[model samples]
Target: MFIALIALAVFFDFFDLMLSGSVTAALLTSGWSTRELNVVFLSVTGLGGIISNLVAGALADRFGRRRVFRGALLLVGLGTLACAAAPRMEFLIGARFIASLGMAAVPGVGLTLMNELLPVAVRGRWVSASGVISTSSLFAAALAGYLLLPWGGWHWMFIIPGAGCLVLYCLTAVLPESPRWLATRGRHEAARQALSKMHIDEDGPLLALNTLERSGEAPVDRLFTKALVKPLVLGVVLAVGFNVATTGFLTWLPMLLLERHLSISNTLAYNLMMSLGIPLGGLACTMLADRISRKAGIIGAAVTALLLAAAFPFTSGYALIGTGFVLQVSMGVLSTLIMGLYLAELYPTNVRARATALSMATVRLVMVFLPFLLLTLLNVAGVVGVMAVVVICLLVIVFAMFLLGIETSGKSLDRI
Candidate 1:
């Protein structure tokens, strides 16, 4: 069941990564003017992610993880088909938002559900596997682009995945709910029943629930309370820093390659090569997640990112490819580490999803302005110089994680 859910969630999570490389082609063929397409379609995509994540997090806390999990898949499937049939940019935008709600819900709640189900000893491995699944889907999406674009164009790109999501929704209903969430809601029998399905009979850990009860009716604003401030601030800052560097570099790589006198096909090939590097790096990091300190892993990955970003602009051929490989590996690892454990560590079970949502939302906001900023930076500073600035931001993240991040390996979600 765990393996199955991870596969389903990966299909949903990285569908956006697949779309990113091909969106311009899609927009050109769709016949919507740039004015309508940019503001409406892109805005809906970003906003849908933010709103869906926020709502899913809240619903996960108030109801249970499975409630949001099931609902999210249905929403994504419908949204995908809606996007396929979109007659105008506005209609597409709305449908994308609906799909995004389902898309975003999977991560925050899915992670929570996985953590709840697994014992601490294998928790890191479980989360790391989830990361690999997500990143691997990214590589697959790129492959899909290479194969599918010539035959069916963008609509089929979405149509196929949308149909796959429909099948996943059926599979999702058969999976067990989070026993931890059931226990907190005081449904002891239900919790036990769910746990039995997973072949466990022991009562689940109660630290998270006990902590929430002891906190005793604290207002939602307390998410930023003194004890929470360090992790919250660090989490948000690190999220923004990472996204700026990542989205900036990956978004412009093909154009950057073209500027260096490479042919268009070769430039795309390099990009595909980099995309292929993602899963390899992600898998390496996942293997160590259980063995290494989360903070140490993240700090190592950040410093490596800084180095890779600085090096990326100077080399080409084997050297450029080597640098891109290292950077993607580190970025893949750190992103998985941070998303898999950092947010889960920062907030107790009761508020974990909400806290993660807030940090992710801030990242999305930065992404909104990043495209133009990246273009300006590339024009002004050249690729090497732009990468240097990215390295500096990554340096800031290294410092933040070292000072403010918490170690979460083998810990209970509720205690975190």
Candidate 2:
């Protein structure tokens, strides 16, 4: 079941990861100005992702993780197909947004569900294991774009994920609702049955008991209350900052390389190198997050990202390309480390899904504006100048960590 759930999580995420990159090159060639469309697409995709996050999280809390999880995959499939058949830029933008909604749920609900299923002993490890899943999705997207583009064009991108999602929907019938969620809603008997079936021991009862111990009435307000003011702000602001720095850097990487005289094929190869770095980073973070601090992992990653953003425009030839690859690898790990652990740590099981969804939504919102805004900034000041600004932004993230962020390396969601 753990393996099956992980597979499901990875499959859906792979589909989402490729949507933007696969279409990116094609968009540049579609006679539409890639710059403007990228801005619109990034904005719409991020906005849509957040909306889906909220919808999926709330619905999972209300309906059950299995139901919403399966539904999200179905939506991703349909949305991908929508992208494949979209005729105009407007239609493509809308389709991407729809896809964002579906993609958004896999993180918020899927992570929450997985954490609930696993024991604390291996929770951080298991969560970090999703890094491999994310890495595979990213790699597969790159392979699909590299191989299929010459044959069927860009539509194959969406078609493949759509097909995969259809298969996932069929397989989803066997997955159980999250036991924690069931217990939280007072379905103790049902929750116990589910746990027993999975051979899970009743370690500390469930979240319901924890809630009872904390607040005799309810913690309904804790999700948005003063006690959690720090976490709430930290989650949104960190996500926004990270997305801006990462996306702004990645979206313009190839162009920056091109400016330094690398060919298209060379740039693609460089990108593949960067993609390889993501999982390695995730693995490192997974190992360290449980031992050190989640906040430290984020800070380390951001600082590295800042340095890489600066280095890309200065070096040339193999050094420049090598540095780009290294930067990407670190950024990928940092992103997964922070997003997977930190965001999940910010909310309880009851509002975990909602809190995560909102954080994801904020990232998407940043994506919408950052891509366009950064590009314009680049046009005005060239690649070096643009990266200098990003360095400052990344510095701000480090400062935020010291001020607002809490350590959640080995903490449980209920306590966090």
Q: Say which candidate scores most in TM-score.
A: 2
In candidate 2, position 193 carries an lDDT of: 79
Q: Per-residue error at 356 for model 2, in Å?
A: 1.4
lDDT of 1 by residue, 1-416 (tens): 66557555655666653465444333543444353354345455556777877777777777777778778877778788888887766776777777877776776677767777887777788777777877776566666655655444657667766877777778777778777666656677887888789887666454236845445323568678888888889888887787667665664465567568775456556667777777776788767988888888888989888887887888889899778877888878876887666766677655666777788777766655655565567668778656766887899889898777787776766656
| Alpha-carbon shift of residue 234 in model 1 (angstroms) | 2.2
lDDT of 1: 0.70
Candidate 2 backbone collisions, by pair: 43-368, 46-364, 50-361
- Candidate 2's TM-score: 0.90
lDDT of each: 0.70, 0.70
Model 2 CA deviation exceeding 4 Å by range: 30-33, 150-152, 212-221, 258-261
Stretches off by above 4 angstroms in model 1 are 25-43, 86-94, 150-152, 204-218, 258-264, 379-389
TM-score, per-candidate, Cα-based:
0.88, 0.90
